[model samples]
Target: MAATGFGALDGIRVIDFTQMLAGPFCTQLLADQGAEVIKIEPVEGEDSRGAGPFRPEDELRAFGGYFASVNRNKRSIGLNLKDPAARDIALKLADSADVVVENYRAGVMDRLGLSYETLRERNPRLVYAAIRGFGDPRTGNSPYSEWPAFDVVAQAMGGLMQINGPDRFTPLKVGPGVGDLFPATLCAFGISSALLRVARTGKGQFVDVSMVDAVLALCERTVHQNSFQGEIPHPEGNRHPLLSPFGLFRAKDGFVTLAAHFDAWWVKLAGLIDRPDLATDTRTATAAARVANNAFVYEQLELYTMQRTKKELAAVLGGKIPFGPVNNVAEILEDPHFAMREMILKVDHPGVDRQVAIAGIPLKMTETPGRIASRAPMLGEHTDEILREIGVGIEQAESLRAERIIG
Candidate 1:
């Protein structure tokens, strides 16, 4: 791996008290931007480390793909917060950090005596962020505040599942954990914005993000449509609600998406598909006409598309129209576009015998582009180094380790 030189957030320090996906993912984004993030895990390690796709050859199973992918570019320190000594260590770390992030149930940190209100008293410049299923009472008390939620729960309640899948009657949870990820992404942005305010005012603030709220924000268009038109939106499968020929269609071998929605594009599409007469036909001449006669237009287009292979269709319609073949994971790994853009990266895993390939950073900056500096840390990999930095001597560190206070 290449050195990630002084990045945009080089001077920032983050004390990460997050686990699972949402909070860890938020801190991961900060770490990617060059923040010094110290991930504090329990003595047994973060839960995701046990959630696998583990290497069959590895016996210790220190971490898995789910943990590794979201935890790259950060240091790990295992501390049993159940111990008062460990809690002191965490407070000390937070006192020196510019930001502190957590995603536990609302009162977990309070019970641990490490809540943002307590921590900010020692370090007022600290930006504290929380990611929750509904939201914190500090921001707004949610009816489901105390209820435990997972990705599926957030998707089902937040209106995303209602507008997804093949039809209104059958709603499917999205393949990825967008419910957790979207909230985490928003929390990252909230943290960054809070940091800017701290820079100007020298005062820290609480940043809260709700997973349900985040998902609803992502489905904003649906909310407006329902309010304005009094129309309850439902899944339309592979077709757009208002546009014609703007969705996925079947090719001879696989599937392709062709979006020719404008009047001019509709004419071009008709001519390209050897249906020049359809370009001037009253039923399919204009955008509104094509939408009104959508079934007929789609049937005609499918007849032409099903006769051609994906490559054959692309050859004629690639640049002429908005077209792309549906690519699976295997195809994406072999794609030149992903290679040229560095979207796929291979990283070395310390315990695992083989290298692991994961998705790369998407943000591109001309001067301070983020880089994956290192693979995720081994469990408690920096315990000694961190203890030394915080003024613990070797003998005392050994004593703490022996007592299982620090791992």
Candidate 2:
């Protein structure tokens, strides 16, 4: 748990009705910024609690890394929403919330009588946000609106996979769950924007983000290239389409990325590699000329870089050009820059003997910086506390628990 301190979103409260990566990630951001987030889970618990990379010593194995990483700094309340009593509790929570976020498939919330339209009538100032696979018809209808989607499906359908691999024929899904995460990020932004409007006009609006649409937005360049140049973009290995020397190159020990896209940086890079002649040569003098002779340019650059270690190349090019050593997880854990910025944090996890390091908040504020306040909750860890806070008597809470309505 983090020490007591005020955060940017100190007074705002969020009712999180989300599970898995996309929805949890968005609400986690809000919680990190000090929103009082109440995560309402099913009686059986959120599915991500079973995801692994678990601590071997933990006998119970209540939750795993996947759940822990995104769920820090929030309280959990497990309620069986299928039960009418539990659904009523959820509605009451929403009635007092500043923001309500969910990522269920279309119509699931409506069927439970907890849809945005239903909640808005009781709390008109609610900022309701949804992150769905194909989005809701309230904004725009999609043919795949009712279809289920995961990260891979979104990547494949949204044109990201088509441009992500070594060649056009071999498509690759990105290693990270960006398809879910990007939409979550956009939805978080939308919620913040809507909250600002609510403060100004006292009216809240629906904010919808689709996984496919978010991935497409990330690859917007492809759409314009196809429309304007009549060219379907293909995977160009590690190289950029229009920029020369703007991608990865093999080194003696590992790989390094060099991005000398502009002429001045290109000239400096050529000089640093002891090939000043290439800086003035007609074949590679300007950005356009370099792109025209990309094969020869990359070949010559690789010839010089392949003989040097990543460390040796970094010594010469680190600060001068946009150059970086391609680092894996182990390397990143030891990198000084990441340490300096507090991007790697050691967080305490229950039932785990040692502290676990997770990625830290990226947003830094002078007066009200975000922080990791607490570990992910145990299953229904705060159920009774939350119910009591919301005016449910202890006897009623126990009765609900006995009936398996609240975990």
Candidate 3:
């Protein structure tokens, strides 16, 4: 772990009043960029602490892979908001924060006396961000605002699933939790923008991100295609709806993909694959022409691609016309590109001897470069330290702990 923080958001204090994927993920982005994020968990721990890919040999079960991946570069404190004293301490923490983020249903914070309105009154320039299934009432009202939503619900409802999978009737959820993760990313961006605004105006505002709305916005292509051409887009599988030779093809060992859909690339690809005739054939001569005869185009490419292994095809086609073999996880780990980009990061795991890999920061700031500064905290790892930072004495912390108020 590094002693010096990433300088980008060095003094920006974030009170993470969130748990699970969406909220924690958004705050983690800020944390990675050097925000002082103090995560507020429960007395025992947050729910995701038990969401495991744990080592069978480790009896502690301190935290799981799911928790570790999204929670790096942050500090945690356990407090029971049901207790009035605990709620008071939380309010004290929020009073000093530049941002307060949560992903609870509309009224959860209010019920616990930790609403945005109450916090902003005490700290006028506090940026309060809420990520929800349907958004907070301060922004707009929705019938589904009260309904519970996870990644799957957002995917199915927000048009992402409709535009995926093998066919129209068999729409499928994307493998990753895009619904949650994308909204979390958006919320992070929103928080950054809000911070910039605070610098100018010295006024805080509510930043609301709806999971379904975020996914729908991500599925922008589907909306435009329907509007422009009256085409209700279907599941595209591994092919594009408007281009030929722009999708996956069979290889002897595994799958290979290419985007040789442009006329220049198509002609070049055909020549490279020893089918110069495809460049002259009227059916596949032009990009639009080949799209009209897509089946024939795929058939022709598959004829060549299927006979070769993915490595063989890559050797022939890589960088010549936008082509590569489909890489699995192990292949990704072995590839130098990932290491060069610093995309795969290894962080220490509690109760495990060896470090585990998680995805790293994607942004590349030349001056204030971000890095995973620390592993996810064990439950309330900084409870005493944070309490002292917030002006609570050691005796008070011990008393709170005895009363099951703080952990």
Q: Pick the candidate with the highest lDDT.
A: 3
Q: Rate the local accuracy (lDDT) of all candidates.
A: 0.89, 0.90, 0.92
| TM-score of structure candidate 3 | 0.97
**Candidate 2, overall lDDT?**
0.90
lDDT of 1 by residue, 1-407 (tens): 11345478777889999999888888888888888889999988988998988888878788889998899989889999989999999998998899999999899999999988899899999999999899999999988999878788889889999888897678878999999999999999999999999999999999999899999998898999999999988877788877897998899999999998898888889889889988988988888988898888888899999999998998989999899999999989988989999999988886777888988888777777878898888889999888888898999989999999999
- Cα RMSDs of all predictions? 1.7, 1.3, 1.3
Error of 2 at 382 (Å): 0.8
lDDT tens digits by residue: candidate 3, 306-349: 99998899889998999888999999999898999999998888
Write one digit per residue (lDDT tens) for candidate 2, span 36-63.
8899998889999999779889777889
Estimate the TM-score for candidate 2. 0.98
Which candidate should be chosen as best, given TM-score against the real structure? 2
**lDDT-best of 2 and 3:** 3
Query: Which pairs clash in the backbone of model 3?
Result: none
TM-score-sorted candidate list, best first: 2, 3, 1
Q: Give each model a TM-score.
A: 0.96, 0.98, 0.97
Q: How many residue pairs clash in all the candidates, one count each?
A: 0, 0, 0
Runs of candidate 3 with Cα error greater than 4 angstroms are 1-4
State the displacement of the C-alpha of residue 286, model 2, in Å, after optimal TM-score superposition. 1.2
